[model samples]
Target: MKDKTIDYLLRATWIAVAKMYNEEASKKGSTMATGFALLNIDPEEGTPSTSLGPKMGMEATSLSRTLRSMEDKGLIVRKKNPEDGRSVLIQLTDFGKEMRIFSKQVVLKFDEAVHREINQEDLDTFSRVAQTIMDLINNKKIYKKQIPSK
Candidate 1:
């Protein structure tokens, strides 16, 4: 059936992508997560865990732990917001910015590979489909990672 075919293709694509990611960064963890968070956050305004959760689809507590781990990694530093002491703003450390720059290469490679794999028509269709899926899932927020339970 068409539904089954679509499901199979989607699952296969996901597995392939995940496998590629694992191979590319076997030791991936806080660094990548921090990079993603840094990417979504405002470069100047910064952002807080409460504002970041909806984007990453993670719970606030989960985002907090992830930020703590990244802080321990020295990838980011959190400061209590001066305007609102109740909130904390996150900023990437110098090391994190360097790491993010390096990781951009990985993203570039992924983009090149994707472009090579799909034709123009397919790419357009994919863009639309992906957007539709995200719209269904994201609730107008950005992307984020879930903090693994300890």
Candidate 2:
């Protein structure tokens, strides 16, 4: 397309960010997804397995696979939720806590860089625009259902 659309820019930016994160994570023998999951899980109080999926905006299958990999790497352990017998809690191992700190630093570094480069007003505008887009999608305002008359 000759003209770029909002989605194009959003997707391209996200892809670039993901690639940059993946590169940094690779040095630590991890992936962007793993780092993301680590950040989302509560350090003190473990998060529910079912909640992790919605919280991370990931599908169950993908989250399951990532959890499995983390488990294999000794990053996390699944324990029965004391309060909810039916649900499992995802708790970080000591090693997982260490990696979570690393992930947090990496994210903070990126945020610092962006703040240093962009002016506050521009950043605020960008944030507002992003939120508006999300609101539109979440509120189902983008596409309306059409009724066909017989």
Candidate 3:
């Protein structure tokens, strides 16, 4: 290819961002996945174990591993949901709350830096483009089955 494609650009940018986040998280002895999960969990009301996977766009197995690590770190506790007998709630401990704050600050700092560097109009266009890509993927419009002519 003579030039990079849209997907390539998006993938490269996201990879860089993920690496940056992981580096920052490592300084505090955490991973980006853990920080992301912490941010997704509700502080006041515990989140449902089943819902956490979907909410964080994580697979059940991966989410389970991360949750287990968090539990081992004494960052979170799993309590049986009083409202539902079959489900459990993932509640953060004081330590989890503290880490969540740190994660939030890291995300906010990145956002602030981007905003300072990019104008609002460019940011808006970038958001719209990203959303459009998401919509296409979510709607399954990008890849459809086609029958071959005999």
Candidate 4:
């Protein structure tokens, strides 16, 4: 990692985390994207299909495919939104709820492990720094000027 840039470190760390989640998801006969969608969905009330893509930061086509796969796995069902006849709602099945709990536990275990290893002040600073980076990217501040390559 000598001479590595911040962007390089960010990408590497994210890839490692994603790989870990993917491996865990594979053991449960699911994918990380499905688990993420499950976690975002409301347990009691169904989530609107239209909003799922933005909520997951996923493209509509990708989300549609994942939702279809979940439906095929008997993990979820799509119902017409009663409030808005033009919209559809995505609701988790019993099995989906079970998987959601599994996803939650996986996240909690990772969080607990990190918490145990890092001091509160360090963790808080890391959180702030990460959020700052996200905010900068979201606001398009990081790419305002083109970089000169070596």
| Among all candidates shown, the one with the greatest lDDT | 2
lDDT of 4 by residue, 1-150 (tens): 789999899999999989999999999999889999999999889899998889899998999999999999999999999999999999999999999999988889889999999999999999999999999999999788679899
Instruction: Report the Cα lDDT for residue 118, model 1.
Output: 88
Tell me the spans in candidate 4 whose CA falls farther than 4 Å from its real position: 145-150
Candidate 3 per-residue C-alpha lDDT over 1-150 given as tens digits, one digit per residue, 9 for 90 to 100: 459999899899999999999999999899999999999999999999999999999999999999999999888999999999899999999999999999999999999999999999999999999999999999889997688889
Superposed model 1: Cα runs more than 4 Å off = 1-5, 27-32, 43-45, 134-150
lDDT (Cα atoms) of all candidates against the true structure: 0.72, 0.97, 0.96, 0.94
In model 2, the Cα lDDT at residue 91 comes to 100
How many backbone clashes does every candidate have?
A: 2, 0, 0, 0
Q: Candidate 3, TM-score vs. the true structure?
A: 0.95
After superposition on all C-alphas, the RMSD of every candidate to the true structure, in Å, is 8.0, 1.6, 1.9, 3.7
Worst 10 residues of 4 by lDDT: 139-148
Better of 1 and 3 by TM-score: 3
lDDT measured at residue 113 in model 4 versus the true structure, 0 to 100? 93
TM-score, predicted candidate 4 vs. hidden true structure? 0.92
lDDT of 2 by residue, 103-144 (tens): 999999999999999999999999999999999999889986
Worst 10-residue lDDT window, candidate 1:
25-34
Best of the two (2, 3) by TM-score: 2
Which candidate leads the pack in TM-score?
2
| Prediction 2 global C-alpha lDDT | 0.97
Error of 4 at 108 (Å): 0.6
